[model samples]
Target: MALGHRARAVIGSIAAAAALGALLTGCSTSSDEPAEAAEQAVEVDPALRAMLPGELLAESTRITVGTESGYPPFEYTNEAGRIVGFEIDLFDAASDRLGLKYTFHDMLFDSLLGELYASNVDVIAAAMSDTAERQADYDFVDYYNDSDAIMVPAGNPEGIKNLKDLCGRTVAVLTGSTQEEALAGLNAAECQDKPVEVVQFDTDADALAHVQEGKADAELTQWSTGAYNAKQVGSGDIFEVANTEIINPTPLGFVFLKGDVELVRAYQAAVQSIIDDGTYAEILKKHDLSAGAIEKATINNQPQG
Candidate 1:
């Protein structure tokens, strides 16, 4: 199979580690917390509110959301030490539209699914993609899409501009991620003569550090995230996204455990309501993530179909 085709087959694995590193950093609640609040409250849609399950609105009128806050432009700690990002903004907008209150908890990314399954969280608003495999275990309210890309040191020291360039070179990837699989497949099929050397790290920061310290020639992650990290943590001078096409672009969304059709419907309607009212676009623009915007909210998005 061609690189893109092979990439599509492995995209499911990609979502598994999208924010592992970010999640590990923990939540940031600054003194200026209220300042990080959403700029505007959305007008609630009565119909959407009516669709919410009684349990969701019963006791507190709040949806407890689990988020991995270390990823930027989506969910990350700002200079002011408060949790803020386009995803948080979107959550605030959706809650307003649905006339519901929400409280976010910061935790490890790997714990998100377990928490959801245990009813510890009503929703997961992390930048999690709704891959088909995950859909089997949960329902999704799809919002935006993104892709995995490469990041290399500044000045393109290794002259690594594309996936092919990773051949015979040490490449850093998140441990247990599909990105690792994709690179391995590419090496086995296309770079047999000079197989890509793969190094797996527990977190994105560690993987990135490997690349920065010259331990690895390239690192793979969400393209937007790579750019954000390169700028925010690396000072924009230490790294640059390699000029290569993404192996596969994936849809990112909010997750709820399986069998919550009512809650799922409520969230989907609330999200679509924001899209229609232009609130979604404004939030994305505010975070410079307008490119990640999706036109309509979807349930259980399975692009591989």
Candidate 2:
């Protein structure tokens, strides 16, 4: 469905309202409940907590985390060249709780996975969606839930509203992302007879740039990514994100070497502790991102490959 200008404004207002409400509520559970009840609220496997550090270091130590610091609101280097965002802060909270230290290495989003697989970095916190295929290569600590969306220049000059609308148009997507997979499926199903051109970029910003310059008809990226990008570069009016169903909803998580059960458990415990408290929600709110928070089911489900 084509969203009218008024409709887009309303969606923007709703997104802002939800973000503010989440910030005000934070992550605090019901206060009337006993501490024991809150503690028992989420049953984290004891095996995960068993991986705690033997002795907390007096001085700060460092754990290397790989991320493409260009994907703002997720992980990105600000104007000062400092890496900051939801994922960075989440990991900082995790490190603080674990009494460990960390440093972030920014690289191409796609390369972060390879760096983890090669043991080049201890972990990856790059807003990476955890999928069965990816789980086969690395362990994950589920955190954010995300879906795909389409970004078109303001006014949607081309009248693009959804995937089906792009029957013969060119679409830009980041390499090595679920968006790519989804676009491939869409093309195969709807445009196979007259394939839609898919242009892959090394970074999401690059892909969005393609749309901005009219090189691409639409840019398919994570919903949050598109929202943040449009807000930042499109002045909240330069680009419009289409709420179309594309890929299956997936949870974004941190990736570590496969079989590192010990580390995964430790991270999981840290994440749970943050969630049980209010730190996790606070971080999300700070970034205007709360819809991305993991739901109850996602937290309980065991990681599967």
Candidate 1 per-residue lDDT, tens place, 1-305, comes to 11111110111133433433455345523221364544566777888888876544553444557787766777877676667888888877777677777666677665777767766566788787677777888888899988887889888977887788888999998764557767988888889999999998766678899998898999987777887887876457888888666666878889887877777788888888888888888787787777778887888874321
Could you give candidate 2's per-residue lDDT for residues 77-141 as a string of tens digits? 65655666788777776655665555555667777776666555567888888888888877788
The 10-residue segment with the lowest total lDDT in model 2 = 1-10
Decoy 1 TM-score against native: 0.81
Q: lDDT scores for all predictions?
A: 0.73, 0.68
Best by lDDT: 1
Q: List the residue pairs that clash in candidate 2.
A: 69-76, 154-238
- For all candidates, the clash counts are 0, 2
Where model 1 places Cα greater than 4 Å from the true spot, the runs are: 1-25, 28-38, 176-178, 184-195, 302-305
lDDT of 2: 0.68
Q: After best superposition, candidate 2 residue 206: deviation in angstroms?
A: 0.7
